[model samples]
Target chain A: MTAETQVREPLTLKRVGRFVADNPLIPLVVLLLLLVGVLEFMRPGIVNERWIGNTIKFAIPLAMLAACQTMTMLTGGIDLSAAVAATISAFVMATQVPIVGVPLAICIGLLPAILMGLVNGFGVAVCRVHPLIMTLGTGLIATGCLQVYQRFVIASGSVVPDGLAWLGTGRTWGLPNSLLLFVPMAVLIIWAQRRTGFGRLLYALGSNETASRISGVRPWQVFLALYALSGLIAGVTGLLYVGLIKAPSLSLVNPLLLPSVAAAVIGGTSIFGGRGGYGGTILGALILTVLGTLLTLLQMPEGARRILFGLIILTVTTIYIRLTEQSR
Target chain B: MSRLITKHGWTAGLLSILVLLFILTRMIQPEFGASGLDSLSRATLPFAFATAAMAVVVIAGGIDLSVASMMAVAGVTAAVLMDGAGDGMTVVAVIVVLLIGLAMGAINGALIVLTRVPDIVVTLAMLYVWEGVALLILNAPGGAATPWLRQLIVGPFLVPWLPKSFVFLVVCVALIWVPLKRSKLGLSIYAIGSDELAAYRSGVAVGRTRIAAYAVCGLFAALGGLTLTLSTGNGEPIPGPYLMASVSAVVLGGVVLGGGKGAILGPIIAVIILRLVRMDLTLMSVDPNVTTIVEGTIMVVVVMFGGVIAYRGRQK
Candidate 1:
């Protein structure tokens, strides 16, 4: 009986280690739980159902935006213009709602984003321009166009459509209504990453562009489609965010740009490309949202808060990198 | 002449473009003369220095997203230290501010080396850290620059037509950049940037060279900050639109983004050209908002052109 007991204990320990090594998401989930525990301990009863719902509501838009980063980072590129595209879509949609009906306005609003994405794709894939510079240039152009457009539409009042507001802020069965849109989107992305030919193509191109080209991958077509899809996602994110905020401004989604990149990076996506998934990115979004709440509860000044935020991101990323490297 | 052009074709072409733009600008604003040049030089110095800072790092195969934030920190620090100080004290303050800039850059290098983090991630994090420090030092933008320092930096030199700022720029290029470019360390920088593995195999100190490159970048960024304070006569905790502008300038000046193949003179010229274009837009009474569109368009076009040239070269 004693020999059997010792053997069983070692087997259980080995199984746990193997489980952790196989699932990278396990550590992130544990970290998330730990953070929530700390938050609950600090302020009793703050982690209620309503608070959970609110956090999920805010995290949805971020996760949507981070989707752009995840997909682009998969191809070893980044879309700096995602925030700009989102802003343009939301601003255009809101203003056009007054002049035009909701359905038409939404279509018209999404046009600019898709067009910008096409241009980015052309520059990166055809012209062989670096993704960073291409996106940066396009972003600045989009911002300028938005400003010019703003001047023309200043006289027309803007309003959020009722349907969007419901989708953005409504709830059902203790879950955010955003989940209605987010769940399908997240499922599509995860499925595409794993099961689709295009998904495998993205990974192949990111991991080794030259080899992919040699294998007749037709990279230009892939890049063009990829960027356009990214733009669409960004536009949708903007619509969701505007509805959530209930106000649309020229710089509506600008601040989310860096955070979205951070989310992707924290999700264990390599900036160098070809490694990561959207599931990790969703978790990353939730973690950042919770961390932000914790910082706000600290009641620090803006300067101190920023400093602490930067330091924490740096430390967390460093530690996470070390752990993953060792496990591998 | 053909040999010279072959050797300095980019410089020659850029100079011609500069001259053409200068003529166009002079035509639009008839008042653009020597004094106009003086003001232009003053306005260009801060950005020129900023572009130089970015150029140095890019040439070394690293990008510093924190340069603008570094400028802000240096500007506010100098403003806080030099406010209401005597000439002697202001001189000391200037030196100290420059040193602080150097130190900030060195720390960025050290952190990247020690942490084994990518340059972009480390610098991106430091960007916020330095910006927060700037805000902490001066919550609002209201510090004054010493009159003597301001005059020395922004005012004209011995000749009325020759702005002190222009002279300072020339002196910096000749003293700092040229010497470094000629030195063993500078060669090592280029070697490592072009191929780090090969450079390391050939006995180059990659880490130290990179650290030195960042340190130089920081010094120039501080100079830019100082120029900003002198011209504005106040300290600004917030960074201006220098980051994108400097990056564009560096790229426009023909520096390769992936590093190892560019000159400092190119970015300096690019900055001037960009500044000239902005002035031209203002003179033509175009909407200020449209200026950004034009700038973006120009950047895209130039990069596309460069890409085409490189593609053709590769095919050959």
Candidate 2:
């Protein structure tokens, strides 16, 4: 074959652009936009500054948690302890804020999550425990710890301190501070994913650990750091959550688990590990927030809303799988 | 034979734990001797059914995280249908509820086989879908039951003063055990799970087997839901979202996470153990919250030990 013909046979720039255009997410994104517009039309004040701000504020912690989960999942593992870590972190922040102040408490809050992450990494990477079972065990332990800690120290049905509320419940420039915090975090994560050597190693390890190991990449180190980073993110998000609610309620952790996983998966990260960008995860988070809001507006019961949410993730993942299959 | 013994040793360990916990509970709370055993036995049955249902899919190297949600859907749908339909239609309603479950499972299998999404994500999504559908049908938790249907299925059938639920549970296990162990279909499940590409290339009909596995999972989930409704005689909407953890119970039963190994009996024993543990916690005056923690801890230790043993066996 001629050089030109051979070059053209494989995916070209034009084919790649076309593939992006034809992606299922593109249509879903469009559909989401239309749905938002329709909701706005039905209720003219639906997209007001305050409402939009609150929604963005409510979603930041979860979206950040999702971002962290996306990273671990991209590496072909999962962070089952995200919610538990968050729960523990929130409890620590709430109980300790009176003594340590907001900033230090925030830092301390992140420690539990980071520690859990280390445990996950150590077990899964060094000890070679399967990620699912290891995390399941750790997650349970962390959750139990949160419950025990809360019951012993924190007063039931009470908020910790009014001063600490500024972190989560504060408004700046007509935006939630937690929402503002997400901006820099998201940008930094995005930059790290694209520019850093660590990002490249992560993708390599995820795609083929044995090959990467043979190529002189320390797969275990990368796996450990990735899990640590995942837990760290969850810890950070948990502090943000405490700021938002100004309370330590273990129940908050319960609902957050499935949704974060759903968000990561729906954002196009392959569960088999490797091959997804954080940009899609951001959009995926937005889609999740929008869907929940839309369902509430539609006046559906909690059960129906839940079912629809699960179904949406299922549909999106299926479509994503099918599209990728076809492109290949 | 040694390899087989080592491989299946986790099941024995789990069974012993169940027995030990039961004995411990009797010693701790003599008041709970007979009644506690009965309550624990009843609680264990539903989860046993649910775990067995999930074990099928897990063995096929796929998981049905949505089993609990599917059960919720079936229970709600069946309850609503029975409530609306008069007494004469009870049998048909039962059939319809099971069919709903099968259909839901079929949809999940079709989506997975057709689109080839990872089974975890697909089932996770289906979990939400079924949950939503159940909520739409029943705005809140309320169900009416046909008395005859309830009496026939949910009420205690006596085998000389013994609750028939245990007998029936054992019977279900036997039926599932024989066909899956002795028949070709069962072998195909293990074959495909152990190595999908090899099974497919060898012309073992991987796609069909996977679809059938999910269908059976759904069928079992339906049975669990229906039995639960009958046993309680209350059709509450709450259990669908919460039932996902029972999948872990099956995994704790020594079923390998990625499939291709483990047995139904392991999960059955795990369920019994879990129930007994809960009873023991109560007898020991442990807070209820700690029960979940204990269960999670046991699962971690059991699975880790099991993995180590399996790795060693593989090396040998």
Candidate 3:
């Protein structure tokens, strides 16, 4: 109400705003830390080294999928087929791992995923189809292909070798083995999003396709690469799932679909595109993982946990929209 | 008629496909006579309603991903509440279910307008919330609807063997579609889809209209849920395959995913086409595994076909 008070108050708020904009992940990290603090106080056992390590392990696959979602979302496109692509990749790996060693089997497994991504990208970029429908179509195709493959190619098998257990549920130096892939993948994804020409293309295309086109940006080629990148990431995420879950089932990837999108959205990635980085998404994935752990600790119904995820996405999106809208 | 055809090309195309598929299917398995057609109509009824619901939201330049969960909640609400109640309460159950659905939709519309978040995200979140609530209400999916209530919707309404559900569908479409298409709000809805800023500048109540779009969508989604409950004779808490099926039906009907075009009839016919494809496959003894492939292929083809149409127009 007073001039001096109002001016000073806004100055303080401005400093806070600048801080948040400079490091969007700060709020998420604070939230994660606060959550951990509260959970530790409530249960006293949640902060142990083993639990923390295992939670990160559980989050690794989701974080990987979030990378896929985040990259696609950056380009104002989405990949509904990513989870299914991963499933397809895992299917190939599961069936072929015994015949071909792990490395060769992994390469063969990723081929289908890359092809699926190529189709999704082609449909979205060249054909000018909406990304939602394109991904949906490819997702269905992936599911159908899996069914057909099972019906004909290899009906029986998919036993995980004991050797892979160390990679999956094993630990090294008091940390999750899966962290090796996740930590580097996160760093690489963030770097690509920030430092790469392809990353700039995504931002430009998402922000204003028409202007980008007039500036000599070939949207088709960029979208093709972006979608293919997402597909490729999705395959890697799928292979990671084999490490986590130890076997491949058709329904394995179903639950991961929406959560991946939620992670990116919660991590301050604009669904409208042209904004966001992996730093926030890492925290987003961790937040969800911790929330699940807490809910399970509290014996909450699975349904309630799902609803909580929805509300969390809604709440975070609203805040980010408010934040960005105010800034603009 | 020609003008109508030109105006509603998607509807015309869908009708042709439906008619052709029907004739071919009945021919393939002569055992699938009038009864087969009747059953197919019955099978397609729920999806038709769901597609109709989606059409309203999509026409308003919005998307509603919560269709499956909304339907599930409605069906569960009706079945769980009406299980032991006498015949008279069936009406109450229907009314309550419909109101619940409208409220759920209102909640979605409210979140979107008040927060101004994207419709897809809001609806996607609602999808999750509603799915959770539905599963919570009846975890194992065992609830009952009275026989009379099922008969009321599915049994004879006017002429015997004509299928009351079909008549009800026609009536519902005429009631919503005709009036909605004629109203100023209808034009404004399409205007919003074509260009939100222009529509808003021209004095359209964007926020209010969107809420109404979603609310009306809720009504039809609930109706669709009721239809499913009656046919199944019980409640299904899980969203099941209805989500993808409805989405496929709507897209195949030529309703643009970005909204602003297409009609209720197009989606209705598309639903029949989908169900018929499965029915045809079943009768011909072909593998059902190909059904998902066919559905997916149809979605991609239909959307691509729209692109082609637009391209040709642009060239001209």
All candidates: TM-score of chain A: 0.94, 0.87, 0.94
Deviation in angstroms for A301 in model 1?
1.9
Q: Write the residue-wise lDDT of candidate 1 on A1-328 in tens digits.
A: 9999999986776666556546868877887888899899889999999999999999999999999999999999999999999999999999999899999999999999999899999998999898888898999999999999999999997999999999999998999999999999999999999999999999999999999999999999999999999999999999999999998999999989878887887787777888888988998898889988988888877677777777776776776666555544
Best by lDDT: 1
The candidate, 1 or 2, that scores higher on lDDT is: 1
- Which digits, one per residue and each the tens of the lDDT, describe model 2 over residues A111-174? 8889999988887876667787688788877777777777876543334555446757788888
Off by over 4 Å in 2: A1-18, A21-32, A98-104, A154-164, A301-304, B1-7, B30-34, B81-88, B145-162, B240-244, B312-316
lDDT of 2 by residue, B1-316 (tens): 9897777777878778877876777688776544454556567666888888888888898887788878888888778878856766878888898888778888888878987788888887887787777777776778877777665533345543345567678887788667876788898988887889998898899999999889878877887887777767757665542353566677787777788888898888888887778777867889877887887777777666666666687769
Computed on alpha carbons, the lDDT of every model, listed in order, comes to 0.88, 0.76, 0.82
| Candidate 1 residue-wise lDDT at B224 | 90
Question: What would the per-residue lDDT of candidate 3 be over residues B241-283, giving only the tens digit for each residue?
Answer: 7777777787888777777887677888888888888888888
Off by over 4 Å in 1: A1-21, B1-3
Please provide, for model 3 over A1-328, each residue's C-alpha lDDT reduced to its tens digit, 9 standing for 90 to 100.
5999989987766677667777788888888998798889889876989888888988888888988888888878888999999998888888877677677888888998999888888888877888888898889877987888877646557755454556668899879888777778788888887999888888999889989999999998988888888889999888878777986887677798888888888898888888887888888889888877776777778678768868877987787667655533
TM-score (all chains, Cα) for each model: 0.95, 0.89, 0.96
